[model samples]
Target chain A: MRASIVQTSVAVVATLLLFYPVLQIVLLSLNKLPYFRLGGEFIPTLESFQWVLQQPEFWRGLLNSLVVSLTTVGILLALSLPGAYAFSRYKFKGKDALLSFYVVFTQVSGGLGIAGLIALFAIVSALGLRNNLFALALIYAAGAIPYHTWLLKTYIDTIPKSAEEAALIDGAGVNTLMLRVVLPLMAPALAVSSILSFIGAWGELILANLFLSGENRTLILWIYSLMSNVYSVQWNRFAAAALLYSIPPVVLYVVLQRFLKRGLAFVY
Target chain B: MRPQWLILPGLLLFLFFNIWPIIYSIYISFTNANIKNFPPPPPWAPEELKQARPPPDFVGFANYASILTGPASSGFLGAVFWTLIFVALSVPAKVALGTFVGLLMSSDRVVGKPIMRALLIVPWALPLIISVVAWRYVFDPTYGVVNQLLYAVGISKPPDWFVNKDYAYAAMVVIEAWLAYPFIMTVVMGALANVPRAAYEAAYIDGAGRWAVFTRITLPLIKRPLIYASVMTAAASLQFFLVAFLWNFIQLYDRFMLAYGYYWAFGSPFREYGLAAAVLTMSALLISVFMILAIRLAGLMRGMYES
Candidate 1:
């Protein structure tokens, strides 16, 4: 009983320590302190939220994030499903090598080699695709494919080959087998990958900052820019904006928590 | 094999955007191609030659030489040192804390295990930028809740958290540890659940204390997962740009300047592209060496791979 009490106490302390900042932000956002002073008495006010809502940039940035995230997810699914099926079902040469490549590729830093990517972007711009959202989506999709394919392949592997074989025996075409037999079974994996891809594209700062400059800034970049200068560092407003920015990813994760767990189980 | 064609689209995309950039970055690291020096003037114009070209001249080894011996070298070295400190401190703390929580969650003594696990993941699931920003607020010396709480408890004043380098590094370490521990904890918890209980029972029957049982059985069982998590965390921490960049951008935007800043000022930020590439490539190489050493030390990979 004593040990249990100690464990409970420790867990409580750790959890509180971990979340103190978030709690503080929530409090500050709710309480409208007259001054920016840290320890001043505060009264509740909706001024921060009011300010946040009035900013057109906030809504536009959020929309851009949504568009990029959703488009990236859609493209990831369209590419990963058929690709994962082919890799899982076919005993091709260099299969192990290809698998290893994808795994290692994801493990490597996506942002590490941005300069080369910027150079390539220059080349693409020369081809007249500069500052295009579709181009950004394609870039995100390309970066996401390795991990998503690996995830889907792992999920597909768990479904017995006999299921697909039986479908084939019933005169199902390859596309039909993939569409009818494998895809449905892979829904959990698809959901998880989609969520991961969405969150990744949504929260991504460096790539977007690099590629999507000027009017094309994502929500994260916009929020980051708000705090870029001391003159613009309005704590209340930043906190409110942060709360708004954090909502979508939080909602998505909550909705897809189960699928994420399953997907994580497969990957790890 | 018609289905094989489906692989081509994804593979081609990956090759173009993913693999090609990596290769291009590696190649550029060996050159002196700075974006600032692009569109060089006619070669015959000696007067134009005197003007600092925006695109970097093909000065082989000059960039690398500068990186090692230039005035900015110490700062780069400092950044590397601090990064190492951050990783070394945070990774072990995370592993230890995570394991303790994992053990507690796995044990029957703990109540509300699901809630505990879920709470642990909240930090991990919170978007990193938001979490970091939240941490900045909490550590805000003027109006931060930390200072407020401390002052309420009779402490007269708290130190400037992000201003002083030591405190700044400490704050970063704390935030990073929080961000990372959940991942390690979840992985360790999964491994702990797979640990056979009969061994612990037998140890208890043999008059073993809790510490002895944990040290002898639990630690050894979860060794592989722990090593994997440690190495991955180490690698991730070494290349940590976001937190540092954000923190510096927030606190010392004017004061802090590096090679990247110089490039940005000149309007051809790609001047330091080669150096940036080299930095990451070296980091990857270092991580690979560490991973191989870890795998050899753990000895699990041998069994799995040999089969």
Candidate 2:
């Protein structure tokens, strides 16, 4: 009983510490004032939400973000499905070498950092691809390939190859075998990869900041811009926009939570 | 009919977008590619301006020299030192705190586990920008709850978080730890589930204490996942950028390697892309060396190849 009390106390404290910032932002978004203060006015209003909802740029940025994120999911699945299929099923030359390279490089890819940004900036501008949303999606998709391919490949390795062998023996081509036999069996893994890719592309800012401009700005960029001026920041409105912007990813993440450990275990 | 051909599409995209950029970045690191000459404006630009800012010249090792032994060396070196310190301080904090919470939550003694878990996972699930912005408010110094609580406790004039360097650094560490612990905790919880219940029963039957059981039995079982998380988290710490950049880029840019490289590229008036590339190249090399050492030490790659 004593241990239970101590455990409960610790759990409560930890949960509060983790939830405090999120709670503050939620309250700030509903506060009447444009800025936040600990003991200031307590009048509640939806003015910030109204203001944010009324902006044309808000809608445009939302559309742009959706387009980029969905396109990323599409391209990512297109690339990773085949790539992981090849990896899981074949014993091609350099198979182990390539897989090792993927795992090692992805681990330290953060090291490469934004070193490539300069060249990317140069190349995009020179090719008239600046401010192009699709081009931006291509970049996000490309960066995710190494990790997601490995993730799905690990997942594919779990399934028995008997069904695929039967399909192959029945005269089904590779495409039919994959789409009919493998893809359905791997729906959970596909959902995990797709949602992860969507969230990544959705919240991404650095490359988007460089490659995009007015009207092509993503939802994250628009919310970030709200806080840019700093001196005249509308904390309430920014909070509202941020909360609304965060909804899709948060929902998708929660839905994906059950599958997260299994997917992550393979990668991390 | 070849199965290998299936890899072509991803390989092509990866090469064009990923491999090509690194190669291009390396090539430009050896050239003087700055705002004046690197990215020529769209074709609609003025003819004279285009002619004025000609193509980048091959500066050879000048950019590398400036970063290594030239006037800019101090900033680069300082950023590297602070990044290492940040990683050292935060990774352990995140892991230890996460492991503690994971053990607590996994205990049968803890009630309302479902609700607690749903609440705890919010930090990890929400988009990062929201959390960072929210943290900005919490540590606002003047109107924030942190200072308010400090004042209530009879302390006066807590240091402004973003204004003071040390305080800002501390705040960054706190936020990074908070953001990352959820991931570590989840990983720990997963690992814990795999631990045999019989081992714990045996330990208790033999008159083992809580600490003894944890130190001897639990630690060994969970050590592999913990090591993996630490190394990955450490790599992430080395690449810290967005939070610092968002919090106070001007003051904190010199405190992180990537942010420092960012300053050279976009923050500086000269737009020294070549210098920025060199800085990033060195950072990449450093990170790779660190990762290889950690992986070899931890035997992390053994599991990957086997799986």
Candidate 3:
């Protein structure tokens, strides 16, 4: 009983320590004087949130973020669905090598540093796609595929081969087996990947800033530029924007909470 | 039907978007491909592929040699060293803290395990830049809550976290560990469940000490998860940019790390693509070396669970 009490206290302490800073941001958004008054000034106001709402760019950025994030999720599912099935089902010779390559591939998560990306952006533009959300989504999806393919493959592995064999024996073609037979079984993993891919594209700053500009700015790029702006950077506005910017991801987390627990239970 | 065909779309995407970019990035490192040299037009402005200018002159290893021995040499070295230090500090600390928390969660005594698990994901799930920006405010010197709290505790004359090197380093690492530890904790928690309760009971029946049981049985069982967490965290830390980018905005350039070094090359009015690419190429090489060493040391590749 004493040990249990101690463990419970530890859990509470960990949660408090983790959430306190986030709490401060939420509070700072409510309070007007973030800089002038450091002590607990609980005077709540929505001026900053209102101010962010007034800015046309914030909404535009949100829309662009949604577009890019959804695009990335679409592309990732399109590619990883088939790729994962092949890895999980096929009896290929070089399967282990390919999987190993994908494992090492996750480490290159930086996705060509912003500087290198700038150079590549030049080429991408030359190919007649510049500051395009779809173009940026392509890059985002490409970056996500290697790790996610490996991830979804592990999920696919958990489903017994008997189902696939049974489907094949029913005279279903490979495409039908993948689409009709296997995809239904992958619903939970697909949700997990969708949430992850969406979250990644939404939060990504370096590539968004490096690739998209002007009208195509993602929410993070807008938030970053707002903070970096020298003339006028209100802490209240910064706090408000950051909090609002985090909503899609937090909502996704809450909505897909169940899938993530099972999907992430074991990652290979 | 050829099984290989299913992989072709994924392969083409990887080749075109992933492999081609790296190859071209390396090629650009050899040449002077800065915007000043080959400026792109405004986004709204349309430009045809036929109108795009020819590539710049290849300067061979000049960029690499310059970054190694130029006026920017020491700054680059500082960044690399700090990157290594940040990784070295943050990864191990996170794993340790994560193991403790995971073990805590694994205990039957811990109540509301599901709620704790869900709450822990907040740090990881919240957008990273938001978290960094929030921390930036938290570390503010004058009206910052951190300073206020420190002074209230009678530690007057608290260090300005952003300006002070040691404080900034500590602050950055702590924030990273805070964000990262939960991930390791989750992975460890999952791994812990895999360790059969019977195994522990067996050890207990044998009258083994707590430390002996953990060291001999628990450690071996969770080795794969530990290695996975270590490699992922190390690689992420080595390419650490977002926090550094925001933190260094107010701080000096020397305190910056490798990723920012790459950014600085391009951030300046006179864009230096070759030099920036040199820094990038080096950063990628550094991260790859770290990942390879980690895999070699921990045998992480052996942990890949497949059908």
Candidate 4:
């Protein structure tokens, strides 16, 4: 089929519109000034990057973000993997009911709103878990359970049960079966799930801002604080930090792109 | 060895982290819990620190009453009104634009389909905070690309987005659509691929026009996925917070349901925890009601489990 001029033009324009904000950020990160102006002078330099790199908070925030995200992924997989395996293999009473519950729970999980936050704050404070990065990661992982379990359950359903049966017949223990047999085969799904959870924990702001403080702030939180500063914001440094912060998630999403369709299938 | 035992650990974690807060929130909403009264030091702390604060008093639905019919009602109602409007407008915009782009790019006729798709995916791929901040920049009154483009096109004095309520809301809807459309597009692209080419061929061979083919064949085929996407996006829009919160946190804090609760709980000087809990509980109830209904309407759980 011949490409229509109208369709091509519309698509091109839409692409440009979508890409402009990111392009603007890229430009702002490179621009010499701390702020942007329309038709601004275009002297580009690495000063903003240098400034961001020089800040001790930058390294701390990045490390905190990494710790939180990786721990979240670890906890998420440990919980969701076994849960998904059971859901896929077992026929328990209330199975459908529980699955339906998960469907609803995952859908409105974010709707917990301030009520969840306030109650969580109270709990975290009471337990003295405030500013604790691992506890924060646990919270992140817990929030992800229903959806990731369902997601991995769906993926597991596709894998033949014959292998597990064969392993059982060979006197393989359940632990060995899971650790050696299931885990390796489920790598792709595990990768998708972990990467998703990692990105989620990495980019999360509200909970991180509420639960963490001072030196414990995540990279996204640090960048947000810079922007939220009322009196003056160094926009160039903010843009540079934001772009740097965005790299991991963007790269992960692109990697996950191949599996996105299948993932959405499980989600809906 | 019961397979069910495997689910226990995750279930306990979910109960602790997800379910417990909600239950606690409901319990707290009925009490006059504020920053001072609640959040007493851990029981493990010394007796003096534990004795430093008294327990919260039970208010017995007073918070709900105040939010329902008292002075705080206006903010709550206004948030409800605008949240509904935002969801109503933005969900369709996102879905439609996504469908349009998905259809255009999925077609064999589109040039550089790979590049176009990659460019489109940027918004969805980038961290959401970054995207929102970049969009906040793009809508900046003085130096924003939106205004710059408006000026270049001979429309001077484009309304300052963050300064005006309507413009800010409009910018939010635009940003929401931009952030979300890629997912819808991906879903549509996936659904479209499932559509049998023979069906389209059969329609064309019968002399059906493009519009007829689309409305009759294409739409019906992708209807379920589209409905699913709409329901999910609508839920997301209903819970909309961060973009608006980031755009102009203080001014717009009371304009969305979650943000309103946020204002009461944290942003406001009073820090009315009970009242904020009441507001958020109502919001959560509304969202669950909408989601359950939509899910039921779409029969989304029909094949979710086998046994």
Candidate 5:
């Protein structure tokens, strides 16, 4: 009984630790006292929230986030769907090597390529494309290719090829068969990839910070820039903005938790 | 059956954007590329930064030589050391904690397990940018929750969390683990649900204790998923920046990891394109060498994951 109590206490503590940061942010958003005033009395108000709503940056960031994320997902799916389909069904030379390339390439961690790309984008920005969300989306799509391709290819492999071959023998063209028959069967995989890709693009900051400027900032950049000058940061307003900024990603993850589990299982 | 030529567009983009950058990084290592005297004239202005910034003068191996004998060499070494330590510490901690939480949630013994599990994934579900930023604030010196709670107790002077190098580094590790362990936990819980109940019943019948049953029966069954989680987490921790950099700016130079080094090398106002490319080229070379060795050692090339 004592051991069980100890275990329960430990579990409860761990769970509380997970929720603490979120709680603080929520409280900070609604509180009258600035900086959350840890021991101060709670006086809930919507003033901070109103302040966030009044700022054009919040709406701009929202619009930019949606555009960037959607364009990224669109471009990613366009590339990954076909690339994965071929890798799955085709008997090409160096197919295994190619698959290995994607797998290994994905493991190369942060910003090695981004370093080079920054210089490229600097020049591109000089050519009057600074703060362009499409250009940002294009960079995001290119970066997402290696892993998304691998994921989609693995997913495509699970699907039996008999249906595809049957469709082929019925004199259906390749594109038609892909679009009509195999596509519907691969809905779960497509859904999983799209959600994950959207989440990635939505939260991306490093590139957006460097590539974008002025009013073209994403939600993350806004939060970061607010925090950049730490001394003058209006804590209540920042917290309100932070909480509002987190809505889409939180919603996406919650609504599609099932797909994420299914999708991530294959990633391992 | 003929899904051919469909890969062309992706391949081209990958080549143009991704592969080209990597190759360009290597090529620029041999040239003079810095933004000190940039956009020289009409030909240079509005031209590709690579051609205009870099003098188009081939300075063979000079960039590499400078780094080897540079003031930043020690900083480079320190970054490498800390990167290894960060990876070494965080990966195992994430795996172990994730497994423990997974076991707790999966077991029928724990009450209110549903709420516990939901709360556990809150960090993972939220935007990482916000979560990381929140963690940074929580570790703040005076007005932060952590210090406030510390003062509310007995200790009046709670050491500034992000000031000391050791404290800041430890906080970064903890925050990152908090952010990431959910991935492993969720996966393990799912994997655990698939574990055959019959195996446990048989183990219990054989007079195996709880520990024996877990270590012997449960562990081996879930080993593959655990290994995958470990490798993924390990790779992530190696390049961890968002948490480590956000926690404190002052101590960053003392422990600048490879990712930050790369960021500073080229991303700064007066970009050192040639030297930055050299850094990236060397970093890539080292990584590929390590990866090839890891693959060969594990025999991962020939369908180790096929089953």
Candidate 6:
């Protein structure tokens, strides 16, 4: 009984510590005080949200984030579906090697290696593609491909080949079989990949910073700029922006929580 | 075989965007390429221009030599040393805390497991940059929550977290640990669920205490996931850009001409691409070595794959 009480207390404390910062941010966003104090006594107000909404950059950044995220998910699906199918079905020479390579490469750091990426971008730009949203999307998609492919490949392998063999016997072409037969069965995996890709593109800062400069900053960059605009930290505005920034991901988690958990169980 | 062709576009894209750039950057590191030498000097330039130029010359080992012996050499070594310090301090704390919390949550006796798990995921699920920014605010010296709390508790003088080099790295480590533990916790909770209950029961029957059962059964069983988590954490730490960048912005404010330039000069900025590459390559090499060692040590990789 004593041990149980201690365990319960520890769990409660851990939970409180975990939620404290988030609660602080929410409170700070609502507080009307110019400065945020640890235990500030102030009536809540909507001014922070008002200020965040009034910013033209906020709306534009949000729009850009949505576009980039959607594009990235689309490209990821397009590339990974076929690629994953090939890996799952085919027994080509060097198949295991290729799969292992992607698995290892998936562990590479994303944004920390920006210098190399920038050098590559410089080369790509010289080839006539200027730095823009599309280029950024392509880079994001490429970054996600190896991981998504590995993920989808594992999920797709769980799907039996008998289904595809049956579809082929019905005079279905390979593409049609993939589209009509395999895709529907892989819906849960697809949903998981889509959400993962969206969240990745949504919150990605480093690549967005390096690649999307000058009139193409993503939403996170815009929020970062807002935070560091001047000497005085705009606590209210930053909180409002954070709350708004968190909405899409929060909604994503809530809506797909079940499927996402199931998919993660498969991967991890 | 035709289906294999589907991988062509992805393979080519990976080669171009991922593999090719990595190789090219490795090559560029050996040369004296900087921002100015980017376009490469005009085909024909004056002798003085040539003399004054810090061209992309094949001065083999010069850049590495400069990093080792330059005036900024200490800072470079310090950054690497600090990175290791941060990783050493943060990773184990994260793993231990995560494992403990995960075990608590995974246990059937724990109350509010769902809520605890959700709360744990919050830190990890938040956009890392946003969370770092939030943490920066929390650690703000004046009027910030952390300092305010500390001052209230009678510790009147709170250290300047971001400015004081002595504490800055420590602060960074704490925040990094905070951001990272949830991830480790979630993965660990999953791994712990797979821990065979029978083994623990057998340990108990053999008069093993909780510690012995954990050490003999749980720890050994979860070793592979633990190794994977540690390697991933180490790799992620090697790319510690955002904390340094954001800390510079928040702490330094408008004092510096270039927030990024300072990072390049001292932190892992683009100008020192070679050094950064070397650092990253070394990190990757170390991670690979650890991974192989982990496989050998655990003796489970073959079993896991073969099964």
Ordered from best to worst lDDT, the candidate numbers read 4, 2, 3, 5, 6, 1
**Model 1, position A170: C-alpha lDDT score:** 97
lDDT per residue for candidate 3 within B111-211, as digits (tens), equals 88777777777888798888887787777786667888898999979998977877887898888888898888877777777677778888888999889
Residue A144, candidate 2: Cα error in Å is: 0.5
Candidate 3: Cα lDDT at B157:
91
Among the numbered candidates, top DockQ falls to 4
TM-score of each: 0.86, 0.95, 0.89, 0.95, 0.90, 0.88
In the order shown, what is each candidate's alpha-carbon RMSD? 4.7, 2.5, 3.5, 2.3, 3.2, 4.5
**Candidate rank order under DockQ:** 4, 2, 3, 5, 6, 1
Tens-place lDDT per residue, model 1, A119-185, is 4644454455556677888888988898888788877877888888899899999779878888788
| Model 1 misplacement above 4 A | A1-3, A34-42, A111-121, A124-128, A230-233, A260-264, B2-4, B38-56, B70-72, B146-158, B195-207, B249-271, B274-281, B284-307
Chain A superposition TM-score per model: 0.90, 0.93, 0.89, 0.94, 0.91, 0.92
| Winner of 1 and 3 under TM-score | 3
Tens-place lDDT digits, model 4, residues B133-193 = 8988888877787888899999977888988888888898999999998878877887787
**Candidate 2 chain B: worst-modelled 10 consecutive residues by lDDT:** B298-307
Residue A42 local lDDT, model 4: 68
Report the lDDT tens digits of candidate 1 across residue range B1-307. Answer: 6756878888888788777765765565566555554323345446656386544545666555655678546644555566567678888877787777777777756666677677677776677788878887777777677778888899996878887767776776777777788778877787777666677788888999989987888888777777777766765665555675677544422222222332322224345555655544444455556556655675534422221
lDDT of 6 by residue, A1-268 (tens): 1237677778989888767777778887898975567656777899989998998888888988988999999987899888998998887878888877787566553532453554564566555445477777777788778888888988887888898899899999877997899999999999889988898899887667665766677789888787667265478778888889988887776556688566446543
lDDT of 5: 0.74
| Cα lDDT, model 6, residue B196 | 70
In candidate 3 the C-alpha lDDT for residue B63 amounts to 81
Candidate 3 pairs with clashing backbones: none
Q: For residues A67-181, could you state the per-residue lDDT of candidate 5 as single tens digits?
A: 9999999999999899999998888877788778877777763645544553455445545566899988988898788788888888888899899889889988878888998
Prediction 6 TM-score vs. true: 0.88
Write the residue-wise lDDT of candidate 6 on B64-85 in tens digits: 5654577545645555565566
